[model samples]
Target: MEQNWDDLRLFLAVAREESLSGAGKLLRLDPATLGRRMARLEKSLQTVLFVKSPQGYALTEAGSDLMQRAERAEQAMRAATAGVPVQSDQLTGQIRVGAPDGAANYLLPQVCAAIAAENPGLDVQIVALPRVFNLSRREADMAIGVSAPTAGRLVVQKVTDYHLHLAAAESYLAQHPEVSAVTDLQGHRMVGYIPDMIFDRELDYLADLGVGRVALASNSVSVQVRMIQQGGGIGVAHDFSLAATPGVRRILTDAVSLKRAFYLIRHADDRRNARLAAFAEALAVGLRAETARLEAATAGQAAPKA
Candidate 1:
C-alpha cells in the first residue's frame, strides 16, 4: 500500500481535532469529503484509524501510532518543500497561543503585538480561557499556564515568577475603612474567584485570607480585575495587571504578597519545529521582561498603598 503527503496530512488533522467537522474547518474541506478521504486512507493502510460515533471521531491505537509518524513526515515535507532556512529567518505563519485571561489581557496583547511587529509576516493569535488547554487535542499549538504541568507528552518551561498583592480601587478605598494590615480585612467586601470555579490552586489567591464575604466573584481574571478597577471590592491583583488598571492600587504593602510562576507548555514533538521553537523562545523571553517591567512600574506608582 502507498500513501501521499496529502493523505497523511488529512489523517493528522482528523486525529488532532478528533472530528471530521473540526478537521474540515482547518483544511477548508467539507466533513463528508474528509470522511470519504479518511475511509480511503484507512482502507489503504488496512487498519482502523478512528472509531466514529455520534459524539465524534476517536483515534484508535493504530491511528494514534500513525499520527505520530505522520507528524514527522509533515515536518519533513514542509522543510523539503521550502528550504528550512525560511523557518530560521522570519516566521511567516499563524501561531495560536492559549493562556489564562490575566496574562492574555495584561501581558500577551502587548508582547504578541511586539513579536508580530518584528516578524512582519507572522500572525499571532491569543486564546484566553480560564482553565488548562487541551494541548493533546491541538486546541492550541502552545499554552501559557500559571503552574507547571507534571504529566503529559509535553515540554514545560518556566516563563517567569510574578507577584500579586491585595488591591482595591482608589475610590473604594476612600469610601471604606482603611485596611492597614491583613487583620483589618474582616467585614470588608472582597472580590475574588468563585470558590468552586478556581481552576488551579495557585489561582486561589484569597484562600488564606479567611475573608468573611466575597461581594463580587468571577472565574475570569479580567472580570475580577475589572470589578476592582470599577471599585467593586478589595481583591488580590497581579502587579502587572495593576500597572494597567489605573484606578486600582495595591494595599498592605508589607503584607499579603503572593508569588506565582508561569510556565510555557508545548507538545514534546513541537520542539523539533524550528519556527515554533523560535517563537516559543521569543514569547518566553518577552513575557518575562514584560512582567518584570510592568510590575516595576506598578511598584513605582506614587499612591501604591490604597
Candidate 2:
C-alpha cells in the first residue's frame, strides 16, 4: 500500500497530544474524524498504533517506532518551509495561546483583541487552562506560563511580574469575626484550588500563606474569584483581577502577599515567523501596561474598599 503523508501527520498529532480531543483541538478537526483517520492509518499500516483507555491514547510498539520516523519528517518539512518568505505586514491564520487562568482571564483578552483589531484576517484562541503547556508537543502556538521553560528548543522572555494577596468580600468580612493575623485564617472558611489537581507549584497559594486546607475548592482561578465574590470564603486573588471586581477587599495585606512572574514561550523553530513576532511584541506591550495597573493595586491604589 502507498504511504499517506496526511495520515502520518494525523498520527503524529494524536501521538503528541495523547488523546483524540487534544489532537483535534490542535488540528481543528472533530474528535470522531481524528479517530477515524487514525483507524484508517492503522489499517493501511497493518499494525496497532494505539491502545485506547479512559486515561487517554497510548502508543503501541509499532506506533512508537513510527513516531521516530514521523518526527524526522516533521523536522525536514519545517526546514524546507523555513526559507519561504512570509508577508511581514499581513497576519493570518490562528495563533493559540495557553495560559493559566489568572493571566488568561485578566490579561490576554485585551491583548488579543487589540491584535485582532489590527489584523482582521487573524484569529486567536486562548486556552485558559491551569496547567503548563508542553511546547515540544505543539500544544499551543505561544504560551504564557508562570515560569520560563528551563530546558527545550524554545525561546523564553519575561513578560511581567504581578502580585497576589488574600482577599474576601466586604460583606463576608463584616459578618464574620475579625481576621487580625495569619493564625486567624485557620478559623475561617477558605476558597482555593483543589489541592491534588494543582498542576503548578506556584498555584499552591494556601500552603504558601500558612493555611492547610480550603472549605471550597476548584481547579480554576476564575471559579475561585467567583466563589470569593459570592462570600463563599476568603481566597487568594491576583491584584489585577481583584481590582476590577467590586466588594472584594484584601485581608492581612501587610502580612501575606505573593509576587510571581509570567513568561512568553515559543518553540525555537517558530521564532522567526513574522506574524508570531508581531503578536509577541503586542503581547509584551499589553502586559507591561496591565502589570503597571496590577502594581498600583498592590500598593492599595487601584480598588478602594466600599
On lDDT, the leading prediction is 1
lDDT of each: 0.88, 0.86
Q: How many clashing pairs per prediction, in order?
A: 0, 0
Per-residue error (Å), model 1, residue 63: 4.0
Could you tell me how far off, in angstroms, the CA of residue 205 lies in candidate 2 after the best superposition?
1.6
Instruction: After the best TM-score superposition of candidate 2, give how far the Cα of residue 240 lies from its true spot, in angstroms.
Output: 0.6
What overall lDDT, based on C-alpha atoms, would model 1 receive against the true structure? 0.88
Query: For model 2, which pairs clash?
Result: none
Off by over 4 Å in 2: 1-5, 19-22, 30-62, 297-306
Question: Distance (Å) between predicted and true CA of 199, model 2?
Answer: 1.3
Candidate 1 stretches with Cα past 4 Å from truth are: 26-28, 43-48, 60-83, 304-306
- Across 172-247, the per-residue lDDT of candidate 1 in tens digits comes to 9889998887988885889999988888998877768777577799999889989999988899989999888888
Worst 10-residue lDDT window for candidate 2 reads: 297-306
